[model samples]
Target: MHFEQANRATGRLVTTGEVGASGASDSELTTGRFDGQDGHGGEDGHGGKGGQGGQGGQDGRGDQPWFELWNVQQGLWLQHQLGESRADSNLPLWQHLHETLDLAAFRKAVSFLVDRHQALRLSFQDTADGPRQRVLPVHDLDVPLVDLTGLADPEAEVDRLIRIESATPFDDLGSPPVRVKIYRLASDHHCVFVNVHHIIADGTSMGILLRELLLCHRAFAAGEEPPLAPLPKTFEAFVQDRQQWLSGTQSKSMETYWLDQLAAPLPRLRIGDYEAPADDVVNETLEFWVEADITEGLGALAKELHVTLHILLLSAFVVALRDISSDDDIVVCVPFFGRDTKDLDGMVGNFVNPLSVRMKMSGSDAFDDVVRRARSASIGSYANSRYPFTRLLEQVDAEARPGRNPVFSSAFQFTRFLPPAKQTSQLDLCLYGRPDGERIKLRFNYNSRRLAESEIREVQSCFQAVLRRILGDAAISLDSLSEPLRQARRTMRAAPRDGRRLGRLRGSRSTTPDA
Candidate 1:
């Protein structure tokens, strides 16, 4: 989800700290507990060591081997170096988990995870040339156990700490790229706050870390060896492979393909219905859902049209965008999974890449026609998806405008990977939909500076209408679908004209595009 423009001339590190009401620096609260107070020594076990910046050589000062960073990682590092290290930046992952847990066993589980995953132990540095990373060699963790059992509002205090820590930027990227805080609310109630920078972990890595940690914790609690598979291939190995691929002819072909896919003057997404200073982006997410039967109809429509459910959802999004922006040519970046081979199955890092899925639409286009275009575009982009988005921005020569991302204004993805939504530098709106049981969970993460809460709600209403109208008829005119929905928003809270099921989908027919 990280976005940035590359090729900056110079960068400077920005170290930030928060002065709490108690006058203790938040950084002190952050690192003070882990300075070997709990049996382990002060050198926290993040496994970081000094290395040649991006040179991939062992440091003479007695550190470890360095790996040349990927293009997206370098972009994120440069942004961080130049002071884009805000809570709204699309680089930090924050989550809180509650369960009955023993502190010692939890600490042991985290320590085991840190040892097993080299990515969790990574550290970065900004050099004159650029930023690079190296893996630390340690295998243990010193977790700060914050006891809030007797506080007047223990739950509220845990929430406060999470907010403060989530806002607390990682000043020194050269330290451990991960932070873990355990808040004890009661003997049986606990909260686990985990924040990891996107440099070493993506959405997928979050699941891997938690799953492995819980597995290890259960085994330790039972005095049994953890039943975990050996990670034969480490993150460093994947880095080498990626660097090799980025240098070869395949990369050249991919660059060529993307450069052609995203031609000049990429269209802007102005559907947010307002314009403000682009620099002042804040994250606001509005969530809604489509009825279960209509969700089934969407699946049925995709099946009838011979396209994946993702493409179908994307086509619906395109219809909505064309209506609002009035742009015949729309580009929506679709983030793709880049762990191509099974060798990378065990390795986790920043491997997700954005595929620029450009669709050409007209008011006269049918739902089937839009889906065809979307499907083709998704296929084309996925084929060349490994070309880093930052590098693609370079070749695409997108305007490095003050407010928005250099490439696409909006992004859409069908994924189960749900994080707290926020607006970033590159997106005006990020529309995500995933299947939840029989229903579709839709979340619209928007930049509040560019969009109003009412505007976002209108979008949700219109999108719901689109989903329903499409089921009743895929060949329904775009204008028919749009005008009715737009009016639906202005009038009142939308209810199904034909009841809760919306328009009941008829039996499947030939939605295939005309040859």
Candidate 2:
């Protein structure tokens, strides 16, 4: 699970950290009492140093390493999606084929994914204590699988297992790219436990893993070894290419714009009433999804307005926040997939970072005007989007609000375009439940993982209202989104929805009432 770092100049292994107790089960070596005060320091026992830590490994070609090219702290972390199964699910497809989890095939798949992606094979080396990147050959990422059939209620059991499995973070330069623990609940029921160094994988990579898992599984089951296509290029290539393309002048301009944006005293827009904390785990999440139709509408509007869908979404969100808080100046974190590199598609590593979308809204600004502003902000951020949100925070040394998010209220993200839901061969999967009655804080974090179908529809309702108010009355200001924004505001902060499950939506009305 751990390896000593190899001396770059000597090309010999240099050991560090207490060599873990020999043959220690990942559980045993990783087990420890963390009071939350100790933080994750103990877990990262010198195994995988992400871009933020060590000097990333370089290539023999004297080229820039892929790890260095991507934003530091961006290429670390993975996303997983858990959904309900339906009787009408695609179980037949799975049943038509053998559904066995073969280790050899899995290893081949892992090796292929790692070799194809530069981020996975990237490592750091040293010269006179100055460490840099050393890209390693792609090899099969070996992860010992523990069969936890003895444990009942696998979900609950797996949660405990994740805590233990993730206790020891990847700290050393390069040993195992990813650690996976497979929990098989039944012949047809199983869960994949994956622990990726936040430096190499992000939410997008998770989608890639699931898709390839099924694709590889099918090919293996069919008794045919699929000949994998070679990667168009690697992350290392990307670094060299991007740097060349954005030489001195272009880089300076981008850097200057970003610096000026950060020059302002960052707005601390409070979303909730919580006593600031000395230091807290602070898993502030904002979960909501736009409806399929509304998403289409936004896409259409973006096309018409000559902006990206993300820009439109960000604009509406800013308008909503400004209206609710009655603050003209606001900021929110927007997570971007920082690929900016060609030939990075299908790479199974973290390549995401947060960007600050600072909106300077005016009371008199029209909704369309706000849209234009939001679009402009996104484009500008992209031009000067080299630094990670973490780096920006570090630069400012911004004091985090005691119990709240440091910079702004929370984060906003959309994930509908990820791999579609898959059908299984075994049990019928139909979700029937309601959210628990808990007062979620407003300093919310939004991503694709948490929202339900009904909730997605509700969000659509609000967006529709906002869009109607905007387009219907061109003179209306971005403040017009306030009414529809209130619907979601009410649902999230108001009393819980009657906790209904799988109920048909009652209204089929257009957003315009007087139409």
Candidate 3:
């Protein structure tokens, strides 16, 4: 049987095979089908240079005016006024490399990435008709390099610089929404930070960009041409195709499914001391990790029950929220990687769609039963997730809630992405992931004005405790859990008007959390 494995040292596909029943030869095994080609490759296993020039029409080089804002982009534009700070929509990725990087090659790589992906050079403008995306021509991008080697404490200076870059919002109207900064800590050690507006890039896009940047940098340092494949489709082409699909029968069917699924009014969970705070509420993040053993156990349970780890964990989250808030109906917004086609696999853009997964628990269902139900609900949502979330809100005519998301305030996401392996020989990259003995890293981002830090930590502890209990016995009832968990539920259920149930609520309670 033929199989493929990625050569971590060189980010290339290598084909190998096990002895098959037919006794295929070694040569045959090594010459098996290679699925990495973009279909625009020549017969000699090299990519064709057909679309290198200005290929008019759908190639995104035609005389088309400003591109229409994608459904999600339009929604973000409409709600831009509601954000507390520009950083609210900023997505920053920082990397610590153990070796010195070639500054010139790194800058060229960044420019190469910008030239390859049109989305990185996108700018938004408001016209007489509506907001549109302007695809700017590719040009040289100067990656800002800060030499902090002479600072008293270079590491602290790097931290300060990261905070500044993260907090500074991109001017989407005036310039490209992506920024790259490199901080040199020593002759060989460096820190790289890349920040992009969430409207233009998603988690997957960051990975794509990093992989290409490393590839280009390595090639440049070696005085060789970059071995990057041509993208089968551009983000602009994706936008056009998506619009066409949204006008098709399949989109109509998806819309119908979403409409029925979201017909009922969403139930809000009041777990914290206060109600949902306004859009301007300050947000904070609490980070924790689930041990490898518990994570392994959860995976075993999920596999045994024929459910995904996401559903299993989501079920636990719902149970915990129910115990804390006494809410039977729960809705948690989950973001899915929106690249559904092979053509879009290597493309970069805001290809993330958040779907509100609602679960109605009786506060008495068994853990296994909840997992099963959640699996079913999640599968249904995934099927229709191609529909724009903004369109769903408009179709359902969801009412605006001042301080919370239109339908749900709380959000849950299981980001199972593995960062691309570093290919540059010069840099020893340290990518973000669970530590040596950890299984899952949990980041809790919540509005500090609505939920106290203590309350958030308590919620994390309770979630961990509940997850352990469920893994121990999937048949256990939610109400039959330990007293602390049960008491948490009761406290949230009967929260007093003074906002002291979870803790002392301190912000203006008129607004709600962002969706």
Best by lDDT: 1
> Which residue pairs clash within candidate 3?
100-188, 277-511, 277-512, 278-511, 323-489, 403-511, 403-512, 403-513, 404-512, 404-513
lDDT of 2 by residue, 1-515 (tens): 11111101100000001112333221221121112221122111122221211211212223333234344432121111111111111101111112457666666555555544556666654345333454664445675655666766765775566546544545454453465555565555555555455445554565555566556655766677544454444455544444453455645565566557756576654323222232322222223344455455655666777665555566766665565445577776654455543334555544454566688876568877877776556555554554444444555545655323455544444322311122111111111111122211111222222233334444434544665455455357654455556655456443224353311222211332311
> What local lDDT score does residue 161 receive in model 2, on the 0 to 100 scale?
64
In candidate 3, residue 152 scores what lDDT?
Answer: 91
Candidate 1 lDDT (Cα, 0 to 1): 0.63
TM for candidate 3 is 0.77
Off by over 4 Å in 3: 1-50, 54-64, 79-84, 98-101, 150-152, 273-276, 288-296, 417-439, 479-484, 487-499, 502-515
Residue 515 in model 3: lDDT: 7
**Cα lDDT of model 1 by residue, 1-515, tens digit:** 11111110011110111112243321232111111111211121223322222112121223566667875677667667778744443233333445678677878888777766778778887667567788876635568989999898998988778778877777777887678878788877766667667667665566566667667877888877688655535677656656666777868987998888788877766555334576777768988887788888888888788776778888888777765555677888765445554444555566666657888766677778888777666655655555677667767767777756766778777765444544343477878777888988888878776666766676676667778888889888775665677575665334433232221221211221210
Clashes (candidate 1): 2
Query: Per model, how many backbone clashes are there?
Result: 2, 37, 10
CA lDDT of every candidate: 0.63, 0.44, 0.62
Which of the predicted structures, 2 or 3, would earn the higher lDDT when compared with the native? 3
Alpha carbon lDDT of residue 153, candidate 1?
Answer: 95
| Clash list (residue pairs), candidate 1 | 47-136, 48-136
What TM value does model 2 have? 0.58
How much RMSD separates candidate 2 from the native structure?
16.4
Q: Per-residue CA lDDT of candidate 3, range 1-515, in tens? A: 11011112111101111122233322232222213421232211112222443311113343434778776677556655454355656667777777769989898778778877777878787789888886776445678889999989999999888878877876454467888888999999888788777677766677677667777887888887688767766666667667777777878987898788777675655656444445446546667788889888987887788766666778888777665555677777654465655666677777656566788876467878888788666656665666777677776756666644566666565544422222211111011123334578766666666666666666766687787888778999765764657454344343343436553332222121210
